[model samples]
Target: MKTTKRVIVLAVLLAAVVSGCGEVTVESETTSTGSASEEKSAVAEKSEEASKASDSEVKAEEPTAEESAAEQPAAEEPADTATLGEKNALASAQNYLRFAPFSAQGLREQLEFEGYSSEEVQYAVEHIDADWNEQALKSAQNYLRFAPFSAQGLREQLEFEGYTSEEAQYAIDHCDADWNEQAAKSAQNYLSLMPFSKQELIDQLIFEGYTREQAEYGVSAAGY
Candidate 1:
């Protein structure tokens, strides 16, 4: 764009210089000799030809897409037609996402709880950029960081947090946990709170969504 502008400015100056020479030749034509007058006329003609050639050169040098866009007039700003309530809802949604992950349904419900109308909540959820699968994955990782859960247990927790069934399953599939290890961790957590016989502890692990093999492995690994 800058290069295009410089070329245009140089072309204009060249035209101006040629116009000045023509003006000088006009005065010389009145007082100069025939040969001298003819000489000046020839110089003026050459100058006019050079100016035309310069213009053609300038026209042949096509502007790039960016340069052509620069030549266009500034566009007007798009109107902000959203209501104040809707704007607030959008702002609130953004703030929530910055601090924590939220599914579309979860965010909509949160906005509604904050007193935003259905229209505002709808606008917020539509406009806010959230990948619900990512949100579910984050929730699963967060839960596992502080507590242990079997795969099914974690999926249930994500669903309770308003993720869809598909999103919950997606999180479970991608969470990358060994069910037996999670069951073992859960067993350890349970034992930290109180004592349990080996069979009783296995039953407890199963109740918390671990498979039978996973539950038995957990209880045996607990040194029972």
Candidate 2:
């Protein structure tokens, strides 16, 4: 009977210890589950707050494309009016024509460089007269003063100075000075300085300005 009482006490003690262990395990599981739930709730709240802040910032920002375009400066327009003195414009036009006879377009561009308006340039060039005929006449007179050139030779010189065919012809027709006599006299004067034989004198006279016939007559007159 004592052995049976001892066995019963030991069994009751074992049952109490097991019950205590089971209660501790249950409390631990509950604490772990509650901590996990609280952590998840805090994380969710933080994410929602961050999302709201981002939305507010985006709404506050200005439109980048429109703002950039508006902030850019405007392009400048070209000036309509041109400035040039009348005398300067006229001088430039004359210099441009001296090199060669220019076409209408070429002349316009030249006048523009001197700062004249298109209308003013055109008017100036039209009114400013270039006397190529007088220029040719001057060249002919200058050439004849040095040596008496043939009519054909004078015509060539005139054409070289920018005179027209008609103008060249006019200069030849209206030459007031008797070139042939002048040529013979010029040759005779040169021969007087350096005497030559009849044939040699004729050659020098012809070279100076006299025609072949005039050269022969000049030598005969000079007592060669």
Per-candidate TM equals 0.66, 0.38
lDDT for residue 53 in candidate 2, whole number 0-100: 94
Q: In candidate 1, what are the lDDT values of residues 83-193, reduced to their tens digit?
A: 999999999999999999888889989999999999999999988878899999998988988988998889888998999999999999998888888888889989999
Cα lDDT tens digits, model 2, 100-196, are: 5543444667678767977778766665686555555655777777775656667776766556787777777776657556545655676768867
Q: Which residue runs does candidate 1 get wrong by more than 4 Å?
A: 1-78
Model 1: how far residue 1 lies from native, Å: 99
Residue 3 of model 1: what lDDT?
Answer: 100
lDDT of 2 at 81: 50
The lDDT for every candidate, in the order shown, is 0.91, 0.71
